[model samples]
Target chain A: MIPGTPNTVALGIGAALGLTLAVAILVLIRRDHLYIRQALWWVAVAAVALAVGVFPAGMDYVGRALGILYPPMLAAVIAIVAMLIKILLQDVAITRQERQIRRLAQELAMRAESPSSKDIS
Target chain B: MQDTLIVIPAKNEAATISGVIAEVRAATSLPLLLVDDGSADDTAKIARAAGAIVLTPPLHLGAWGAIQTGLRYALERDYRRVVTLDADGQHEARWIPDLLAVLDGDAADLAIGAFPERGSAARQVAWALFRRITGLGFEDLTSGFRAYNAKAIALLAGEEATLLDYQDVGVLLLARSAKLRIVEVPVKMRLRTTGPSRIFSSWWVVTKYMLETVLLCFAHWNRTGRQRT
Candidate 1:
């Protein structure tokens, strides 16, 4: 247990929630609903959650060692940073998709403009 | 004159498309292409009826995307020059020749027809801020009525332009980075007849636009190696 660890009830709750989320993600992957590349990151996120849930005391210890006054707040800080990084990754993907969409739109517009292609359509 | 193409990106412009088409046709014998931009209204039908070749994207790509579509078409068709104007009847079509003159004069690779006395106070302030930040001065940096040569067209229609968020300042910054000459010619413009200015409608919009544009400018600047002053 951590030096000033919260009750075991909270850790148990966190473990349940984390496992549930992790299973949900795995189910999505199994059904082929999510792309492997994207799912991999989410799976890692779930792993992080599970790790924290299983070892909540470690978080408190790490937080104190890192000079954080309130160790519990560390989870929130890590969650926020993780969220920000995920957003940045999504933005990069969006930029790629935007470029492709524009190119496709332009190509389709061009095909319609051509007289021979117009006849085919 | 024949080598030039006028591209107007229109969406839901049923009310004013016909008038603008007729005016541009009457003003010059130049071929006109109205990018329909996936308007649910009769934009494509009206433009076709008015005698402008209508090109519609598969989906609604905003004004800038539509403009880029037109630019790509011009590049493919081997046009020497391109003049782009608004379909809202806000930008006058008669000044088309002046923009062309700048292109022909070798004065600049791109000619932007700016209106010093036009636009609202909020828009003016936003433009002023843009000018100060980018160190690019023009009375109407956001003017849609502009002329571009083939070289400028290729640069903007290429992959780099995909990163651009908006056309006006984005296009200018791209041109500037390419070391292309940019000159702004004073052109007459009337206030928009219909709808609101999306970027300058409110303080929040203007702030957001500025932030996005500035971030994009720095992004492009660093990518292009601060190619020019």
Candidate 2:
């Protein structure tokens, strides 16, 4: 309802740009890390939404760029992305734990077979 | 009296080995063989010092493996019977007389020492589950304290008993499958002073034991159609 303000637009654009750059850098550094890559993608989308929510200039740009100005919808998309990322992380963790258990079982069998191993109390 | 060989599976039970050995010696002049299941302590030394013949396995084969090893040794030596007693000081050595008496009377091929009167409620529950699954009506199927005659020794000396992870229930089930007569004799169990029980140590042990017992029951049930009366 207020007049288009340069300061408000600049502040919102600055925050969005900073967050997007940070997420990009994190993704680049941790591309091999599954959980980090997933988290970075969610953060990037959330950063873009936050930018569009505050920056009046971004609203006009989004409408021209994507023909849309629905900032609230971005929040919902970000939440869904975050949930998917969390579930993927949990799956990775469970897989890692199962591998660890297999390794331990193998080690125990080897120890049991080795005659030179120290006796148990 | 027929010569009976007693097999005691000891693991780091040096503190009570001599006493148990002496009591078994005093109760009966049965030849005692102590299978030291790779105890890190002086269990072998003390058992040897107690004048009992000792066999040291290469690794810790656990209670079941140790007893199997001892049974094999007794079978090889041509012992008429083999009695297994705990070296953890929990079982009364004097009750060896009652177990031997039952065996000598030809009342049963296998006489198990039951401790239902002394065990806690949790142990009782475990016992009940084992009985239900294995269809073994014995008061205590998991009782390690037992006496096996020549028929039992020969039957158990086969590949079946050797492959078992736990001997007490597995041996009982195998004996029952072979139609070997099994009798339960009342024996007093004293409190163990050495360490905590392997059963109630934690949930992990309890769950593992339950799973193993259930598997054993399935195995026996599948092999033998007749349930113990």
Candidate 3:
């Protein structure tokens, strides 16, 4: 016995789309074109999208709780929020590294300008 | 190379830096190490004239970054103790010895000059919120007046500290996480010789600072596995 789905065709399409996205991400990572650190987040997002597509009932339950008539719209909303958070975290990380690199450069310059450098000994 | 070194981190404090340097000189005859954090003014020239060895970073890296630079310099020179204060003349140099006394007492690896009545209802409330969240018992969370031993200097000068935006809360959390003792001594801080406090300059800045600090606290808490969740 199996549970019923309102639209099996749409669910199948969503699952296929998510699987394709995950595969593409993996291929990019394997080819060394993409950093694993960043690609992992996309992979997780793809996995979640696939699960929601396969077992749409979970999202349907959530959409109904949130009073959204359409479940696919809910998936889209979740995907947007996830992407925004990923972008924000990356921005913070990059900003921090920028400061670090600048400081390192300055420290090196200061060391160079000092005539009586300690490293010479 | 010295037993005790006073490291001051300055940025665009040309107005009152010479006075601050003279104050430090009056208090102790120890070596003065001034880290100029890319000030556009004549801060480097003034500091040099005041007899402080000035090390100017090629670019602006903010207070914490400058302090880290000074700490690394101290570590390289093998200073046993280091005292750091603001260059805006807000932090009194006379309190330096008191802070060092705490380090000498073997009670703390780091000592902070804390003012319990640094007064501002909003500021107190913010400190209260952080106290409740981080469970850190320091009265002054934003004080730049602090003293550090070799261990604290080594830890702060490393890669782990480079990512921090603010020195106060982040440094406290890092020191506590490393099981290093942090002590506080009662000290009076004067009004800023320059303009208003940068942290409280605008509502938007305050909101952004709060958001970043809360995120940092959560990240550290998770890494330390201190939370039950």
Candidate 4:
């Protein structure tokens, strides 16, 4: 019973597709590979949204299958997935930098202590 | 004469230290002062046994720190010139004579030994970057094998030497700021015998070293500029 005339459905699909393409283009231009991955995920979500919005029956079927309480629940799920992936990737990068710092510190300390004694003699 | 003294900074290099000491001893009878930078092994004992007057720091100072300590010691003992040599078996002892010859013939304040072949690709890249940033024409800025006359040694004996993590490049920069004459002599460098390189293990290590070296160069440039003005 959500108001869905042909004109309104076309407008909704057009807006979503336009926004997705614009965001993907911006992300790609930024050259951050991680952001590009997120943009792609967002584009897929928008595509799905456009498809379901144009077909009211399809939206109702998906909502019912997922037991989604509201029409926007699917969009929320997509956003959460994207956020989790970003956080995981950031954590991995930070851990790698920390490991490199630790190794360098250890090597510097060892080099300082034993001064290539055998070679000098 | 009493114008030059050789300072060899040694750590735990007992096996090759004797041969190196013998070679240097035979090459030139220049009074040798060895700084034993807290070696866990018999490095200090062996160096002393080999007729090198040894000075042991309270704790283990890194290569630069040990070299600085040696410089300070020479400064205190009234030595006019100091030739620094690596305790590692890599640097040929024969090069010491050549470095000294350059210092004497040219009346150079600072004489650096340039290695013909520095094996590692990462090291080559790092050296290239250093040369690009510092604009100093010396091929091997990191080589510890060099001779410093009193003028150059005095410039480096200041408080800045204690703060330096790497002395070779920093000292050279300091010499330039002090208007001391600098010269580079070609010397064949061999691979290090004791342990693996602390830097240049992988791409990540190379990146880290490059970052540190770049920062150090910037720091030296700023300091030198400030001193000049």
Candidate 5:
């Protein structure tokens, strides 16, 4: 009920957006296009978005309680933080994969160099 | 059988690969492995033709990756020591024995063949900064010419050292953390006649290398402990 709160139309649109995101992610997961580990993050984001949409005043209340001067900025801040964590996690995963690939490449080369039992004996 | 293995990590150094291999072969009968880092040229074929056992990664694994591959190979074959040299002909084959001497004498676990005069002014500045930050006393911090014993090879070839992008500061830091004694032996080096340096190839690469190395130094400051000669 706060001033500048999302109107009914905006709330509906937000809800629809959240619903669409949730459905899209689920379908992607079902099709094996998205990993379950990563889908957990999107699922949480969707849940939060759906909650905020259904209770538009909740964000304002939380924002005010946290002493945020501009309520919508809280969403932006949270979004940015989440994105940062996601990107950092992605880099961590990439680092691990890179290491694994390097080890595999080394193994392959070593195997190719080593003569087979038939040749060695 | 020679207890030492010479590892030369080459990338597109087909022009110099044969000469480098021959030089090492002349210097010592130690078995040499040329880790061809997915070179676009015929580095592998040329090296193989020159009587070197060539190990080519299916894809490019950068400098450190290729070196680590060599280390792993050494470790697997139970080699007592490993000496790594550049394929670009900067590192002198004559100094391999000198580097190994430090290890054999038990004066150090790792021996670095340092030619301080080989670096440009900018490289000197970078080396000074790295020495200041890491407290490593090496004059040639970026020297690829180094000798490592079985102990050092085992540690560096393991998963713990897998993610390192550079074999310079990171390897030194890891060695220090493992309580490995490092010593620098003065050596003569010729100027590289082949491809550009991997680290100082471009201004952007230099900047990135500086930032990443500086950050790495700070991150490992506490764990690396005080430097030892």
Candidate 6:
């Protein structure tokens, strides 16, 4: 219901791009390449892309509401910011996993070095 | 079993590991455990031959990680105290008693074996800068030679200390935050006979260390006061 003159060509390209992303994400999730916890974010991103593609004028409304001079730049800015945040979250997850792996490695080494463990071998 | 366990964290120190182990054996009969930090050389084999139980991590855990592994081992064994020695042969075993004595006297929960004479000009500047930022009064802040009582060991072995890459400021800051009694025991250290300094191996590493340490100092300054206790 957003009001704007949406060009047919632009609408077709946007819809195709959104549909491709959505299908790709679903395929990845189905293949078990992406965990549910991580896939949730990608699902939301794909949903957003689909929504924007169906309603390109919505971006204009939001951008104008936010007082942006050029509405199209809003999408670019949001995508960049979202990507940065996603990358940062990945790093946080990596740090936690790294810490866990280190502790596990320590435990393994200690257990292997124990006299009883040596006796078993 | 002796209450105090000597833990040495060595990385590719095959050339010096045997000598260091021998020196420690000569100084004290306390049980020794060497955390072989994924050394490609025969550090583990040599250390075993030298009468030290060695823990070889599946992968490299850096210096602090290796030390923490030993601390965790000591914690699990209910050891009353732990003395950490660097495997570079710099940390002399003769000072082991002095550090343990400080802990035994209940003078401090953590005793740092300090040797200010070891700092070169560049090291002195770095030390001064770190001192100014962190407000730590110890002359030798980066000395790996240290004694930790049970309380300190428990604290450092916990999850809160796993992310620390260096044993210098990050560790001291954690100890400071926990209000552990810390004292410096003057001791002489041997000059490095092997590779270059780990922390100051290159200019790029030095810059990274400085920035990261300064950030750590500022991050904890609010929670932990500038008290020189």
- Per-residue lDDT for B118-141 in model 1, tens only? 777767777887777777777788
Candidate 4 lDDT by residue in tens digits, B1-229 = 4667777777777877887788788878877767776688887778777777776766556677667766766777688889888877677777887888877786687888888487577677777877777766678888888898777777776664555566556666767767788888899877887776645567786687678778877877865564344
Q: Where in model 2 is the C-alpha error above 4 Å?
A: A1-121, B226-229
DockQ of candidate 6 (2 decimals): 0.45
Model 2 in CAPRI terms: which quality? incorrect
Give a tens-digit lDDT track for model 6, residues B36-58.
Answer: 99788998888887778888889
> Per-candidate interface C-alpha RMSD?
5.0, 11.1, 4.7, 10.3, 4.2, 4.3
In what order do the candidates fall by lDDT, top score first? 6, 5, 1, 3, 2, 4
TM-score for each predicted model, relative to the true structure: 0.81, 0.64, 0.72, 0.61, 0.92, 0.94
DockQ-better candidate, 2 vs 6: 6
Candidate 4 chain B, run of 10 with poorest lDDT: B220-229
iRMSD, model 1, in Å: 5.0
TM-score of chain A of each: 0.86, 0.40, 0.69, 0.46, 0.87, 0.87
Model 4 spans > 4 angstroms off: A1-121, B198-207, B222-229
DockQ of each: 0.31, 0.02, 0.16, 0.02, 0.42, 0.45
Please name the candidate that would achieve the greatest lDDT relative to the true structure: 6
lDDT of 5: 0.88
Tell me, by TM-score, which candidate is best. 6
How much is the lDDT of residue A63 in candidate 3?
A: 88
lDDT of 4 by residue, A1-121 (tens): 4553346656677567656665666666477654665576556665665565456556546776888877456756765887798789878877675444433443443334333443442
**What fraction of the genuine interface contacts, i.e. the true contacts, does candidate 2 reproduce?**
0.00
Q: Which of 4 and 6 is the better model by lDDT?
A: 6
Q: What C-alpha RMSD separates each model from the true structure?
A: 3.9, 11.5, 6.6, 14.0, 2.6, 2.7
TM-score of 5: 0.92
At residue B21, what lDDT does model 2 achieve? 86
